[model samples]
Target: MVSNLAGGRRPRSGVEPGTQLGALEAYAAQAHGYLTAGDDELSQLAGLLRPLILESWLRGVRAGIDPMDPGSERGLRGADLARYRDAHAIAPLLPLIDKLLVQDTARTGLIVVVADQFGRVLWIHGNPEQVAVATEMGVREGDDLSERRVGANAVGLVVRTGRAVWVHGPEHFLHRMHQLTGAAAPLHDPDGRLVGVLMLAGGGRVAKPEILALVKATATAAEMDLLLTAMRAVQPAPRDPAPVADGPLGLDVLGLGQPQLSKGGERIPLSQRHAEILLLLAEHGEGLGADHLALLLDDTDLDNGTIRAAMSRLRTVVGAALIGSRPYRLRAHIATDVEALRAALDSGDVESALQLYAGPVLPRSTAPGIVDLRDELRVRLRTAVLRSGDAAVLRRWTAGADGRDDAGAWVAYRATVDRDSTLYAQIEAKIRVLDRRLGADATRMQRSRS
Candidate 1:
């Protein structure tokens, strides 16, 4: 028998020992009532829930989800499901997952569920009876079990927190899900990107600490299998003109925070200035001369020699051949997160584009060009999303840090939703908050003027 981590059935801190279930149920009831009634006092009553669980409930409420609804609201179906499965990166790991977990899950009367990074259940296996029950509850393949769709669950919570978690009984936001318990862990590709979540789900009896450990171990094994598979698939390249780094060059510069470059699974650290230069060069595939680059690099006039010295240092850090000198361009193809985001946007794949855009481009950069590029990309992406008039997409944007303060997105979201809906009320509240903030700012400005 597995020992309970929080001393039994209570997955979070600050709960009374014997009243864990009661507390969770009470909190869930309070949250439900507050959301349904559009009361802002929910936060005051959230003391019974763990911070993470409470946050998940708030997100669900903001999304206008009905806790009583039994089915998932979005997912791929039939032919679409088939196509997605075939193209998914996790496809190769399914057999390995089956070998490791299916028999055990079947015997234990548990369901093994695999979901993509976005929380869409791609596959489920286990005892036929349990599978049927889960299917009836909308846990079948192709159903979106994301927090925004079906409230908190092991799969969605793991994706959201990027950690192993167990959601038991009343910890679930949806009333119908109170009958089930789940433990899940997020899986990552070799490059450290989230691939999906691997979960073990059953009744409340499955909430033991050992079960969480088992799910984590299984997730690790599957990730190792994926990594080994990826390694075997890559053929040896004969030789390169320049000294090649171990793996492909990957650059991530979306956020001002911790921009990184990886080569052969090793991190090559960059100075703030070098990061700015590389980002500028990557953005301008056609290449820029030293003078032009210097101008972009700083607002004031910078000498050509200063720019040349910086480029020389950068070449030494990367390879000399990788940085071409004539027009100043990268010789080899470098994969960048920003370019991927742009490609997705250009292809009209707004969801993909949003997923790829982690944050603004080198957000910390004070350089004129980098700042302009960042703003331009942000504006263009928002314009495209608003133009599409997709409520789901708009909600996703408004829910993120970048869009939380965006009054335009709130207006757009409100316009797209029905006025009588809970979602409309939520957006209206957000708009009111924005209005109050704007009013305060205007008042301050008037006082300053006087």
Candidate 2:
């Protein structure tokens, strides 16, 4: 059913709500034509859209999303969904969510949607009529609401932009979606990591400015509840150290440097062994067994006593409550430098991502898990830099600690940089030196094989 937002009323421009919406709907329709042609940078498109929406359009174009037929391309159901939902960080706050927001949205003609960082709908609730209306628009539970699925939506834009926003009629890439307006806010943990999103979708009733404020307020409350729950779960050890945040602790182990943890602005130094254990725990948020951790920590036959001794020392430093017993897991929230870098890359902010890369994760650590993590982070970051194809970005990357010796990156730099410049000679020299070094290594390997 088409919403009554835009009909026979000749919408006049100004600050009036209906007038602005009508004008936006007209701009969106005009923009939609340019979008389908895969050209978001047309000179004619400038000043016709808000900066944020324009940015999202660029991302959608790069992702090859078909604006004309944007449907949710992925979802989960039944047992698989149950397992994933239960394991999600937002799982614990389900009750708080229901009590705080769900109860009120019922029969109110507004549907509440809670989505994970990836824009997968984890929970959706509201009036049956509204629910049915939403279901017809492909906003069902487990559906992926990301740009790749349904272009230019509030949830997708929030996930990409990491900020709260309201998507008005016609602003959505799907023409049929013009019937609904969606307001959404990102929920964050203590360390500023995106935990999830809270959103409300409807028609004229949703156009109220208060709806956006309501979503933001509820999101804040939800985050507070998460903090409280994490705090309540702590079992601080007898030897009291400085008080840390109640939820997961902030872990900083990027590059070839000493690992650190934090309680807000206060930095806590961590021993190498402690960092390794903490890294493993953070990697496996669900939990890890003693036997499994031992294997990841070393190839040698490591005994439980050694692992116990390490845990004992770690518990004393971070407090026992931060590390759960049983199958070991990090009880507090862990905000890592690695996570921040990935978030930047996800949002298509390669420059910020490059700035966050100090080096490979734990560049000096030889532990199996740390080594794997270092390679994974380095490769991911390198790939993102290469894919960016921005000459300035390539220049910045090739000069960094991680990419200084990266011959492939230097080659890419040469391709992008001007041949008429003095820097051209320097880049060429560096590439040749790297190529020679690589040639020597390959020749040595061939001789060894013979």
Candidate 3:
């Protein structure tokens, strides 16, 4: 059957309730009443009116009608077009709009309309013939047909007020939308934030449950994906720094708070050289053998005998932390599964990655080789974070900054600042000082080489 929409009056601009918002409010109240009464059938019935509402909202704009005011049934007149407020003229939903393109068997020749939480249509699927009729009705993508001023229809009514609604045929205030039946439901986040709307419209009689189920299922899946992505954006890495002690250097290997350098919580102080060595090796995941560590210190004057003496003193200072088998190694048995850690990061499972990197790399002693390896890995990790350029990485690098000896933190800050000015301005005053220090260090190193 040919749609009755063609004979309906085109909207006039200055008409009161020119926009579809008023109609949307009315329908929303009705839907809410149905829900409050525990009338599931009526609630489902209300849910079927979304598509026409969306269509009307869009058409109201093109006709220069006040999008929030009900337009006149009278023919379009220049004097009538003056009431356009353009205030509540937010655009229609777009994300779920494309789904309206496909025809579903459950709702014979139905036109589907889905929108994102922001009221943008995303998918519009429907039968080709029904779509053609809808096109004649001015129901289409890139159109915001809200029922607020455009009068009663499904999408506008449900989404504007975050309620489910159904508007069938002549019940739509605008005579233009009388031939179509529409059902709409609001899409919401876990926190009950409205994210979008799912709608169906057709020329045939509405199949309440079948259409409702389809719209609900689509909304649920989209919400799940949205939540997962949002959660991953802010999760922090899981690593706790070692606590301070007066006696031996304390390093926490198990990631628990137990102190390896003290007995009964009493402090013991190690010599400055021993403390430096312990800190360096503990930061390096790979064991730094004695000889390579000696090179890192540039201590060519020290013989193997002297290095052995230092190792012995370091062991005595932190005996409890000694786990590795070799004299050159910090702890006798620090181990990790690099493959597993990397896999977790690659799979976008950052929580697992943080869990896997939980403990200190080494806990007993520090060697030059270990220090160099740690530095290299730190650089690698920073570069990886820079490449991602995500919001979290930028925040982390910002917090890592201190007055001095924060080269890694400074580098990351600089890398992200140009792209994100708010972060850049916060660290701007400190950037110059860091650059000068770094430059001087570079010059000194070059002079030493020559």
Candidate 4:
């Protein structure tokens, strides 16, 4: 970042030691007025407002968003809103957010806000009265608080710069928001993609340093949860992919090709249904019952009889000695290609993981469990590959079935290779074709709005 990025010789709004709150707010209001009125004395404004806030104010001015008027801003509502948030990658980690932020703020008058990378608020929980106050300031669920949409605010600042930020009182461009303060930090997925933002806001003590610290900590916890969830596929299964003499088993469920089993060093043929069951069993050591398998094996939820029949046939093929009753788990310890992929990922061996990832697991299987597992594995490997920034690994992935049409992978590949190389032009051609499909997600993931 530029030394003068935040204006007053530092990239922040440095409050002087012992500066009164009233004085700071007065100076902040003056700076906001200057920016709104098209004042060019940036040096004077820089002394009062933060460089980040000034930048946001400039964009707000360029967009012609009046400081006196919030203008009309709408977000997903009702079922559209529910469906969107449920489908989001952040959906699984809401519980973690609750434990880390909301519960502790019960009596603090602070409200927690979770917003997609687009700055659209997805969830808001806090003290009832404070929540209502936030709602009055347009911090309700489904509202867009992006820099371009709502000017300078913690959520908007985090979106613009992908960092933890705070917006106190008069720092907000809209007059209505001057009653509260907010601190927000970006929440990223396992692969380092910014998925959303976590924030805390209130009318009291919201500007305290601990507030930003807490927001940053909670955001980190959320990212770690994403990583752990991705790693859950790595249960207690033996790391060795080869079948061992200790009554161990092996299963291969990746690729567009048929899934197979390896027993006593001999490849064994298996039906698609059998493959799905074994893969699920291998990933889940504790095993699953027919009733549970019924839901996972099909969208319509197969009957107990059908699930029993499939398990019965599977038992015979793999030998009953290798299988158990009741929950119907594999009696012998097992290793799988999926586990190997996770090992590669866990060790940060992105290249090895890329090499092991021949394709998505049982790509043709419509079984719900298999689909979720497929996505988990694919997403982990893909995230690792992109973050690795290894040209060869990226090239290999782009050549594979899954990555061939992956626009994001191609774009990352473009960055790692020589700009003047023939390969660069080739990647460019590929990106152009897939560019339209690249960023139709969460409003503004590909680029932060001004």
lDDT of each: 0.73, 0.72, 0.46, 0.74
Positional deviation of residue 345's Cα in model 2 after best superposition, in angstroms: 14
Best by TM-score: 2
Per-residue lDDT tens digits for candidate 1, residues 229-324, read 879977753333444556688788886578777777887888888888888888766566775576467744366689999998988887786787
Worst 10 residues of 3 by lDDT: 81-90
lDDT of 4 at 113: 94
| Candidates 1 and 2 compared by lDDT, better number | 1
lDDT for predicted candidate 3 compared with the true structure: 0.46
Q: What lDDT score is found at residue 224 in candidate 1?
A: 93
Tens digits of per-residue lDDT for model 2, 1-450: 212234544233223333367656767667676556544233333334555665566556655666666454345666556665777778888788788777887768788999986677888889778888887788888776766557788998887667888887777877768788898999998667776898988885676677888888889988998888778877854432334574445888877678999865677899888888998898777676675576467634266689899999999987776787667887666888877987897888889988888777877776756755675567677788888888989888877876787766777778887898888989888876764654433222222221
Residue 302 lDDT (model 3) = 38
Candidate 3 residue lDDT tens string, 150-215: 555677667555666666664464556667777678876556566567777775345355565666
Question: How well does candidate 4 match the true structure in TM-score terms?
Answer: 0.50
The CA lDDT at 84 in model 4 is 57
Residue 43 miss distance in model 3 (angstroms) = 25
lDDT of 4 by residue, 328-419 (tens): 67766668888998899999999888878878888889776676567667867888888888889989998988788776787788899889
Which pairs clash (backbone N, Cα, C closer than 3 Å) in model 4? Answer: 6-51
lDDT top scorer: 4
